[model samples]
Target: MATCCFLSSSILRHPSHTTPLQGRLQTRRNFSFFKITAIFWGPKKTTTPTTRSMMDVSLGTFTLIGSPEQKPPVEPKELQQVSISVVSSISNVSSIDWDACAVDANGQGIFNPFLSHAFLSCLEESGCAVQETGWLPQHIIAQDENKNTIGVVPLYLKSHSYGEYVFDHSWADAYYRFGYQYYPKLQSCVPFTPVTGQRILVRDAWYKDQVIDMLISALKDLALKLQVSSLHVTFPTETECQRMKKDGFLQRTGMQYHWKNRNYKNFDDFLMDIKQSKRKNIRQERKKISAQNLTMKRLRGYEIKDKHWDSFYRFYRNTTDSKWGQRYLTRDFFHNMGSKMGDNVLLIVAEEDDKLIAGALNLIGGDTLFGRLWGCLPQAYYPSLHFEACYYQAIEAAIELNLSKVEAGAQGEHKVQRGYMPVATYSCHYIVDEQFRNIISDFLVHETKQMEVVMKMMQDSGPFKDGLE
Candidate 1:
């Protein structure tokens, strides 16, 4: 016979309306029938063991509590049983299983290459995201009774928030002011990536909802056990944001520039949609490349070579060093990504006199082209080269591949004048301390409204001809 279990009962309140931590005690109940088993880390586990009694509610979530001597918790009939474990690396799980959870999470064939096992593993294998760099992998995996992978969450115990595009330095500063350490907080995101997608990877099983709920519960429990300052899930889908909000996470909104393709036949058709000035400006920029005697090539799969990776890495280092930005990605990362995900990798290179001078890196998605990194050789300034390599070329590639849009990376208002319009990106935060949670919640409320206004303003000012808005 199958086992039934009661997950946990805790008050689920909207973050904004909740009372101060000292004043309220409320409980909300959800039912599951899966046997929930949790594995503890360290010599002596700090997390509370499973038990039958109602767990204490800590800031609107269940805080685990029990001694080994306590009787095993009763399995509530209505609850679905799940087993969750933490792996120090993504390599611990098979790629097929991990990819299954990632791509089939929503029952739709939603594919995000960034979240794929191959891409994430490359980050680890290349040493770009590792304990040494402060992105220690502490991924959460959920499984059903049959031992099938039901869900996974790409999580990390971050020592600092550098690569995550969602800015939280203010929160860190606030923590320091209060004499609290914030470096080792838990984060769920594609390191250095800001594109929105599902962070909680759950398969389209009958128990997907339960697994998601369980994963969130387990995340909170682990945070308490590890005693981290908070848990942040960045760049999750809008639907995921709403679900997380219901579970007490503070919702945040930000913007990115994206160029949407409206079934254009070619680059010329795309240009026609924009205003005459913008179209002429783009044509003029394209002319600069030809005037400089530069040749542009879009290399994919085996067409990209080791020499190209080396050149791109140099360009990347130069770009980052000039800006005083940390070189978070190592040389090996580029080679590894090319080897593992070559088909999905697109490298746009500008060649002059048979020598590569600059390059832009992008990863092809199911229907979107993600523009990630771009760099040029030192003192090799060609007129409008940056615009050509990064923006126009990407748009042309998208048109040729018939992809949906080009999600140029974060925070560039200039993209608006080039037909890329502002779109909202989301993140959700869970603050362990109640006071801080309320403070952040209030700030997000204001920030969200401001973001909405900015998005509308950007759309109005977009390069597209008037009726397009």
Candidate 2:
């Protein structure tokens, strides 16, 4: 997520928001027992400290609120009756049912690792994104009269807007200026993740549309019920963004650079498609690794050992601590998530003289390689090391996996020159006060226009010979 980068507007940076995010979506799988049993990974469970990460996403229970049977804003007669409920943790819902909605939401087969039950639970259980950290889970769910879970929204009762890439501290401050309390606004996202996907996840069913609309209504209803200032859905799909905007959410846009795969056989094949100058620059940049006497390695799944996680933590802190910011993730998060996610985790490290100097972490999606976190040994600056580790290596891995794209997190004009072109990321905000909503809506209209111009300009100047396809 380029966790240290100051994304969005002034609200994006000030008030200590100057960081990236954790994509906040959720899913689950079947399990043999209840109470979050320790589910070991790999052929054998290596000895490690007992942590929440070992608790597998299998079967689970949920707390449901009593909502009288009602027809939804969108009428699908097939759905007899449905109710929406809120829970404090993803653990309350079965991973299989939660993940079902997460998967079917896209209507495409692409799997978002950040949206998975395994990923979201790691953030919560690791204590990285919790009430103490200002991210309290108030996840919304939809179910039919028969108690079948059909939809889910990963949400947080936010005390501040730090983890969400769609910064709104200015909005918060405006509320303060008006003597309003905005500290407890609602956030719908994967805590600390900025990657784009669905936020209102509804399972593929005859009643899908009704479930989606009802889920949204539930989100707003809960916000109003709690008297929160607003509700925000960050990094949602364009379709979801538009739907929410039409339903009165203020649409906001931001830019991110992503690299696409054209079925390239290899990295060189990918380079050949870009402008010659860009291609030459990339080749030269990649060459710097050998010149620096550094060893580059991309370890996946079981290949990543405890020592690698240990080094990556130091590297991550080296970046986070630079902003005088407290770290969002604990060291235990890496081990717990790594052990659970396995091959889905890609740890790219740079070693010099047998010492780990730097590392970049990526999560494998169905078709996209997510460039998540990257950092190096404090005070160790190697030429082009950041690009090689975070961008080029990500592109290479994407190509190798036959993936469609490489999302290089947030904020870097340099990424454009290296063939990562800008794309619009969408978010929508629902302000409760009509007056404030009108004001922010006007602002969003202008910001969206400006964002379009920036995106068009970036597209025109892309490193690709034919521009973005």
Candidate 3:
């Protein structure tokens, strides 16, 4: 509800040798919805004191900073660019280039198991993400002068926002009251996935910004031509959000828990790092599983056999059926992803007397591990099995892989006592209805403020040792 702008007193000079666009003048933009800071780049460097500082710039329908006329210089090779279009299917994209672009940005083609071609292909092939199931693929691609593929975005036209983790149901209900349709909004993200990674895939890292800008421009243009409500990019990194903010996108925030290692040599070392009471509690839980004669095996990629996946699927079903009374994925989905992704997928299974009792599945990213799903058969050790299969095994595997952090699934305060620290996650929304946009924007302002306060509070309660030596 409140907005403020401050101008930079000085500006940095750029050298002429480098591309003028890189040196182009930048203007800072601050928004009232939340304290969002954005810097816009122009084609050439300028030193005007007014242009140097981040100031609020507003775009039509959406608000952002800087002149909309500012454009990056077009490359000569792309001058005769071929027309690219958005398709509602990933089956149309060239896999080699798609994987190449994905790897170029994130260092691996697919970070989240749910985003992998195998996983998506299974969803599409299995009719899980089809029109019948409410998930319709809306693939966005960019091409060069020769019509050769240059970039791609794995998108889906979602009917319901379930499995997104980024909640916006209230916004949908408000829109419904005003006779507006919220379903089928353009979404550039992995289906049924909350893990964050590159949503825009660029062939070359050098043209990263260019590729992203082009994607945004293309999506906006497509949204207009197709008469879609808006484009939603969820679970994007801070960098991607900043870029979108510059291009005039709304920002929303939420919190999730993740575990991080500080040179923990083993699980005991990690326990020692937590509060003494928590340490004892966790050890006791592990002892309970041990006393039930249950042991867990950590399997990676190809090591996960069909039988293992089958048992894991059973475990997954048990948990979902008991809790939600339904399951999201089928057994075939697990087999397909395991066969395609190999070692990137991890499965930890608990066995009693050589019989599998529980299992959990996780997806590994460049620096993060994500706990996707877990379940256990009706065993004597189901209580502690959830923690061992879902959290503890994940932490152990993260240490083994030397990953930076482990993101436990959504909305679990219990994870905090188990070494998972609370961190804020983000999602942005743009409502097409004029009145609704204003209403939701106002709501988001309050929500973001509350989330920020909660994040700060959680940080204060972090289990980490306080202080400087």
Candidate 4:
């Protein structure tokens, strides 16, 4: 599960591995779901899957953590003799095959760089998201009869729910109060990243739908077999959320602010579409960068050198080390991603007297510019640097690149006024026990309605001109 929504001083940064509400979890007699103290982290235990039963499906017999109560519906005959296994490392799969699945799974043209082989592999290789960090990779890989790698999921046997943007601390606390184990649960997400994309990845094929169904079954069965309290597929596409809900998973909804691009020639042309007040405020914020004598530069791929990576890592750590912050990504991750992801990496840095003072890290998606991380020299505070580096630069980059939107990472009401209005985000959960499942499901029902109200309010209060979407 993701941490809480409380945005700290270092606003406009990546969303995961945050200082959750657990630190100050409030309590009162006979409290509700939001009251319980979060048991965020604990002793790291093994989540290695053991063969408990063999599931008989058209694809083939596959190992499972728990046996199904009923047989799965018929799989398409085209997916004959399919094999699914939980691998411990991303290195076990070739980037060529893994990336192919990640790219193809996006029925839309959007590509999530966080789901790419390079990104996940760098997390493991850099020693940031390993078992010691409570993010043990148990990625699933599926193969068809032809031995073609067709599907993959970036799953983790997590001991804590720190970095996931979907908060389930209350559920864990409930499990604790009821004398149940909750840690070592299965979490499907991009580590230290909250940008939503496809979690159940399948290559484009005639049996794509069947493969997706099978993968869903595999995840549920794996959760049961592992004997974890639940399985969480966080930040999936809304369509995937619906599909999972139809298959017995509990649906959930939350909101994040994202700036959508309307057809515009430039940043000024786009600003005219927003309300005059918000537009004036945005222009003033941009002006602060100049008043501070800071030059903002957007560097992509090879344009970002080792020196920039060095400084950017410091910037990222500065952001994470702020109040209630925890550094999730290691310094090496920056260098590794720089070498591996090439042009997909967007590093916007603030320079003063030719010295790098601050930076914001973003990934260029197929149709979006993702604002992931940001920071500056911790000792000095520049007015509006965070907003300029993370928000304005991202919006400018998205427009310049002709991308569809700019996802300014997690929660921030401030972003709405700056053009990143609320957009609904989704996740699905599967509880092994029916009773507990219903309890959480009931809570989700109420929570989803609240989200709908909040999203509508944000939409109605958007900075855009009345005629804009």
TM-scores for every candidate against the unseen true structure? 0.83, 0.83, 0.80, 0.85
Which candidate ranks first by TM-score, i.e. highest? 4
Among these predictions, the greatest lDDT belongs to: 1
Give me the displacement of residue 386 in model 2, in angstroms.
Answer: 0.6
Predicted structure 3: lDDT: 0.66
Alpha-carbon runs more than 4 Å astray in model 3: 1-82, 106-114, 378-381
RMSD to the true structure for each prediction, in A, is 13.4, 13.7, 13.8, 8.1
Model 4: residue 6 alpha-carbon error in angstroms: 22
Which pairs clash (backbone N, Cα, C closer than 3 Å) in model 3? 8-53, 28-54, 28-55, 57-64, 301-342, 301-343, 315-375
What would the per-residue lDDT of candidate 3 be over residues 260-370, giving only the tens digit for each residue?
Answer: 777778888887677777788888988877777889898987789999988888887787777767566777888888887788788888888899877888887767788
Give lDDT tens digits, candidate 2, residues 279-342.
Answer: 9989999999999999999999999999999999999999999963868899989999999899
Model 4 Cα shift for residue 386 (angstroms): 1.3
Model 4 lDDT, residue 235, Cα: 93
Q: Could you give candidate 4's per-residue lDDT for residues 140-228 as a string of tens digits? A: 88886577889999988888889887778868766664556678788899988888899988998766777788899888878877777
RMSD of 1: 13.4
Please tell me which model should have the higher lDDT, number 3 or number 4: 4
Write candidate 1's Cα lDDT for 1-469 as tens digits.
Answer: 2221111112332333433221111111221121112111222112222212112212222212222333553345423446787888899889999999999875687678999999999999999998889888888888755667778899888888899877777676656555557668899999988888899999876556766888888888877777787999999999999999998899988788899999988999999999999889989989999999999999999999999999999999999999847898989999999999978999999999999999999999999999999999987789999999999999999999999999997766778888888888899999987766766676565556546655776687778887895
